[model samples]
Target: MNLYLLRHTQPDVAPGICYGQTDLGLAASFDAELQRIRAGLAEVHVDHVHSSPLQRCQRLAAALAAGKVHQDPRLMELDFGEWELQLWETIPRGLVEVWTEDYVQHAPPGGESFFDLQQRAISFFDEVSANNEDLLVVTHAGVIRALLAHALNMQLLDAFRLRVDYGSLSQLELQDGRVTVSAVNRRF
Candidate 1:
């Protein structure tokens, strides 16, 4: 299985707003960014296309997948819960501090933690990665980072070290039951 991961373009939201499973739209630069992403993926053969249900990812996935995109909730971004749509600075500093100090286990007021996000993302990855097929997944940075961390056997804490830029592409190859990280954060 060869997995290609593409993060959505910059969301149509103001800077510093916390969004997760927020169903945000694409930015004005979406068309241009999609063109670049298409150009970058022109040579890559994709047999299956999957994406997060969020509109930001859906637009790109639909464009790239020729209208057939498998929307999976497991691939959605981390749920921000009470923090969704709130400016990061406006969220209680103490709450933010707690989450920042240990994000892996700490869940936002009504949301799941980073660890929770990893579990669902990795579960979806495991389910789809067992076959000898080329899979393209359009998802969020958090999901991409979690998958990368799993493939590389890196600690979850270190997953943040992997940079996943908007409109970036990453690749993972699985052969003989072993997975290899072919690329990471290749932006067009």
Candidate 2:
């Protein structure tokens, strides 16, 4: 099985806002982003398409798959809870410090921890790996990072160090019960 993980296009959010799981819209230049993504994926043939329910991801998935997109909450961005839509710098400095110290186990006031996101990513992987098909998943950067951690058996903290740019594509190949990463964050 081949997995194509594409982070959602640029979102229509303020420069420093935390909009994860906030259901934001696409940026004004989404069409150009779409064209770039399409050209980047032109040689790949996808048999299954999945997307996060967030409109930012959905818009790109719908555009790429021509309405043949399946929306799933498991693919949604990290649940930032109270931090959603808040300016990054405005978040309580101490609380941010606590989270940054060990984000894998720490949760925001009402949000989930990185562990929760990993569980969701694993669930999606388990379900998809059962089928023999090429898949294109339109999801968030955190979700992509989670999947990369799962595939590469990397520590959560190390996965956080990976750069998942908007509209970037990552590829993984699963064969004979083994998984190998072909790309990390390839932008068009």
Q: Estimate TM-scores for all models.
A: 0.98, 0.97
lDDT of 1: 0.93
Give the per-residue lDDT of model 1 (tens digit) for 1-188.
89999999999999999999999988999999999999989999888899999999999999998658999999999998999999999999999999988999999999999999999998998899766789999999999999999999999988999999999999999989888999999999
Query: Ten consecutive residues with minimal summed lDDT in candidate 2?
Result: 59-68
Residue 98 of model 2: what lDDT?
99
Candidate 2, 60-172: lDDT as tens digits: 99889954798899999888899989999999999999998888999888999998999998899889989978999999999999999988899998888899999999999
lDDT of 2 at 144: 94
